[model samples]
Target: MAEKEEYVKLIGSWASPFSRRVEMALKLKGVPYDYSDEDYLVTKSPLLLQLNPIYKKVPVFVHKGKVLLESHLILEYIDQTWTRNPILPQDPYGKAMARFWAKFVDEQVTLIGFRSLVKSEEIDVAIKEAQELITYLEKEITGKMFFGGETIGFLDIVVGSMIPFCLVRGWEGMGIDMIPKEKFPELNRWIEKIKEIEIVRECIPNREKNIEHMMKIVGRIKAASKTA
Candidate 1:
């Protein structure tokens, strides 16, 4: 464990992929910090509101009272500040490409996957889009062990958080296989290797809990659609 820094707190939710991203960074850096888990479905925390007034989302990393909103920004800050187990590459072009793929994961994969899970009307279309996103990622992934060759990097952290909550939970709870093994053999292998990392194992969202939560969201969406 790293020496405790001056009051580091993260206001996030367990089921939130974005929150999980920051958590993965902190854990990987061996930073000791406090986690304030919020219930997004029920109510919002005052600090979450105060920290992220505009976007109003989880993964608001507060380090020494310097509030950081947005998961990607928090991740960059974590890498620069911690100076240990660096997530982003030091070179200019490597860092740029990493950010590009991370944005794709957020805008394409995460949005499409969540829509598939929570909306009954767009389930099939959304699932198809999610599959296409995974196919694209399979080719983009060039490393043997992770996105950045031997060690986990920024792109890995972004996509890594999605596996347990999105991929694994989607398969187990909804029988939705976004990445088919026969087609996405490389991706499947990458996932297995990323899972082997201790920090990844510890940081991924709870599988069973996320499954139950996703099912509830699907049920509610279905019931509402029937009335509409």
Candidate 2:
């Protein structure tokens, strides 16, 4: 085993894509770190609350006692600090594009995908809107093995993290095919390829378990909507 250099710890939940993203980056970069499993659905850990009082969310990364919240930001920090296996692109333009797509994955894909489930009444409209956004990604990934080109990088990690929940099983569990294989051949192929990666296979939650968890989330969202 390699000698530990600095104190590194990650507060995260196994089922959370955001948490998985950070873990994937760490593993890809060969950075050994301690993991604190914070299953927020059941209870938020006191340590997580203390570290990220504002969001009180999982995937709060701690390096040498310095705390960092937000999965995307933590990914960048890991890439910049580790410097061995670069996650983000080296050139300015490539880095900007990576950041742009990563933001799109979080803000657009995640929101719209969840909205489809929350507004089950407007399922058709939501599915259409989601298809439109996925079209952009389909076009972007044309002839490429990944969003980051040959190797998985910033955009890949950001988008790949959501594939199970946002594009596949989570949606499928709700009887929605967010990314139909016929409609998104390239994207679907990319999904298959990414899933084969050792790090990704290790980090992804079990399909049956994730589906059960997603159903609970959908039920809660529906209940909240009814109250509202």
Candidate 3:
């Protein structure tokens, strides 16, 4: 008896780091998947709504007709299912730490960093808070070539996916350098190393175009703040 063929599909937005991380994981595992580019800012597609009625967000992973929500969860599913080019660490302790850091990146770093960029009145305080959270990452990544040690892993995918927006170009578009070379040497080095990977490079959106789109979003937020 032969095994059934699996169908994998990923619905995601071009600019979403969460979406990119899931895509990167699939690519790393060499899983073939159909991709649907969703522009939810304009309108959410019927399929997206049908698949994820609760959040209706992109980066929804569909494997053999079973739907999975949340990028981190999707990445883990892909890793466990494929069993090749492992994304998470093998050791229990290492795996736990990786999950912890990934959660930190999504919950703490991403939240404070975006607030710092858009909150003009509280920009100073927000930046300080953002930097404080980032300092923890800087220390965590010290003495390592990658978060996974020698190669990109779960934590690397989570943090690296946000590099364009949180660490480098996105901050640059807002006239700020969040990760200075002098201040964060290890992080800067890790950024360069991760960007050199073919999969990471492919997952990254075009630099100029991404910055333009982000600036437009920032403009809208600022305008809304003025009205409110």
Cα deviation of 221, candidate 2, in Å: 1.2
Clashes of each: 0, 0, 0
lDDT of 1 at 182: 93
lDDT of each: 0.81, 0.86, 0.85
The best candidate by lDDT is: 2
Error of 1 at 76 (Å): 0.1
Candidate achieving higher TM-score, 2 or 3: 2
Which lDDT tens digits does candidate 1 get at residues 1-81?
Answer: 233446789988888778888988999888888998998777888888888889887888888778888889999999999
Please give the lDDT score at residue 178 for candidate 3: 83
Q: What lDDT is obtained when candidate 2 is compared to the true structure?
A: 0.86
Question: What 10-residue stretch in candidate 1 is worst by lDDT?
Answer: 163-172
For model 3, the superposed segments whose C-alpha errors exceed 4 Å read 1-4, 165-167, 223-228
Q: After superposition, how far is residue 184 of candidate 3 from its true place, in Å?
A: 0.4
Native-structure RMSD, model 1: 3.0
